[model samples]
Target: MESQQEIKVIKSSGKRAKFSLTKLRSSLKRCGADDHMIDKIVNSVRDELYQGISTKEIYNRAYAMLKKEKHVYASKYKLKKAIYELGPTGFPFEKFVSTILNYSGYKVVLDQQVEGKCVTHEIDVVATKNEKQILVECKFHSEEGRNCDVKIPLYIHSRFQDILLQSTAEETKPQECWVVTNTRFTKDALQYGSCVGLYLLSWDYPINDGLKDRIDRLGLYPITVLSLLSNREKQFLLSRNVVPCRQLIGDQFYLDHLGVSQERQEKIMTEINLLANL
Candidate 1:
């Protein structure tokens, strides 16, 4: 059996202890737990320690004890504690994906299950921007010595096929499908998706910068992307003097601009011809 005394002391002091404590504190703060409540939870967990307890066990115990308190702070603390114990690698990758999609002006729907006759597929994140829908499957793995052999591509194809087959006929087909893996894709997988028009967004891409910075500042939580839009896009949509399209149909200047599109020009000319008698 491992010595309890050394383990207990290590859990309570120096760098390892401080790292865990900081992560817990950051999680609580991000989730709106007040300083006093966080301090109380930390002190309470620290006081209940015994020698020889594993760090993993300690985290589980602390989370369970906090849950019994039936307070909002407890729930917030539990969520953060779980994330810290699990490390922000594999399963928590979804948090990063959701944040990035939101930053790119999309609304995310999480963990949607699509059922087939013999199998059911769960999608990690589905997002919509404008009229375009995208299916994103996130895979997080260690940076060093990672192998994506068969599993990554299998999951991506499964989810993509499921979403494509089950969506309603009237609904927009996913304009693009992406396998957003933390590790770079195998050369074979990349070539295959490229040949078939699928997008493989690896962690090496620029999207990672927006994701990492935002998650650090905002913690592992969802954010709205509408606020992140460019100032020009916002300004163009807000200029008050821009007449409504309905009111400008008969205006020659409006017809000239509408003439840029052959289909729209025909429709506008037909409308003008019909409205002339009125």
Candidate 2:
């Protein structure tokens, strides 16, 4: 019979080793496992693994271990918990709104809280362009469920009132309200939004196309260009006293005239290139 150490080494080597129960047992032991934990981990790994598992298979095994036993070790449970905590589903709803608005030549302000009668509400993102403010509310849902009918209308009504009050006498009133949801809205919600001139944006709209076209025709390049700027670049611009311009111009003129100073323009291009590489 092979020595335990030799068996351990052979079982744990190569991509093919991932399928071996002997390898899992050895790994659990190496990690300082008690017998009960070793058995549990080995069984879990054995059940989930097949031939040709990669090194990154740890995550898959850890996730499966957590789901199998509700009362699993904290370390195992954390593997799945961390996924939900850091998942795009949690906060990227807001990010998605910002991306679309930035593409469409609008400046985004995030998480602005508004106080209203009988309730206090928060707007996920509010976009300003050419003196026209567009209110955006972002929702992330597991499915296209009933909130489309109930929550969306109530949300629109509340935002409509608050936006009206927030407008200054000189500033142009918000021309439209936007609800950007991860899931598609029901038929009734779409009709309601259309009736009130609320622009509903969804995943179906190509982010680059909508933005580029608007920038081309309306000379809304400032909005489109600023949208492309990184959070750091935007901050740098603000620190230097750059502000959003409302003047109407063609795309080519806006790019040549107002996009940036020669030095700052080079910096912006470098940043965009780096982000593209990433």
Candidate 3:
């Protein structure tokens, strides 16, 4: 117990680092868990910590505790993991971003073919607002702890530049290229993206306006975050392009298709309404 302070946890990157109480506490706090609940969860988690434990295990333990307290807290705490649930493919993630941009008042189109200066490129998402057009490239990784490296921005910047050079490109209205991801950006990725003027959004980058910030601010959580839905159920919804919890709120008949019981459906929608009304 005395040596618990020195315990090392394995990250998804296979790197081991000393566990920090501050980091764990901050994450719980972000989920809107108050000091009292935070203290209880933190102490409980600390008591269970052992050397060589993985971060995933720590998160699962904490998430279970949070869920026991409040479904809303647990849902929000699971935001990052829920985003991961968006994909075995990048397409669902792209649709997820398009949905967010749409809620933010942008007209969004997905998987568009645009002619660049040299070759035609398929844009993951093209968002337009008030005559401003933004081309978004989404990078989705199925695994955690994989950060977007400098090479990503470095490579995408060239394609963006080519599109910028297109004389016949549509609208041409103050086009901006954005790179969005569900993970963190490497230091070089951030630097290169900034230096090249490419808009970058990741889990926690850009301080106040990262992907997580945007999601929390908008209360636009993915349906995958719902606690009662099994993985099979979530995948069924995703296959039907039902990504946002708000969207599912309108069309929960998908729940019926899965043969979910009326009682279970009520419980699921209760959780969704809590998030939707957040």
Backbone-clash count (model 2): 1
TM per model? 0.41, 0.40, 0.95
lDDT tens digits, residue span 1-278, model 2: 33223222112224133134565565444323468866777655555454444544654575455334432222222221221222234354365347546766789988887554445667778789888777777765533222355458667866677757765665656666777654456678777777777776543323433322332333222211332344454344333323222221212233344555667555444433332222
Which candidate number would show the highest TM-score if scored against the true structure? Answer: 3
Q: Write the per-residue lDDT of candidate 1 for residues 33-137, one digit (tens) a residue.
A: 568867876666566655544555655655565545433334344432322222234544565566557755799987877554346777788799887888777
Count clashing residue pairs per candidate: 1, 1, 0
| Each model's lDDT | 0.51, 0.48, 0.90
Q: lDDT-based ranking, best first? A: 3, 1, 2
Q: Tell me how candidate 2 scores on lDDT.
A: 0.48
- Clashes in model 3: which pairs? none
Which candidate model has the greater TM-score, 1 or 2?
1
- Report the lDDT tens digits of candidate 3 across residue range 1-278: 64777899999899999999999999899888999999999899999888899999999999999989988889989999999989899888999999989999999999999887799989899999999999999999989889899999998899988887884646674379999999989998998888989999998878989988898888889988888889999999999999999887889889999999999999888888888664
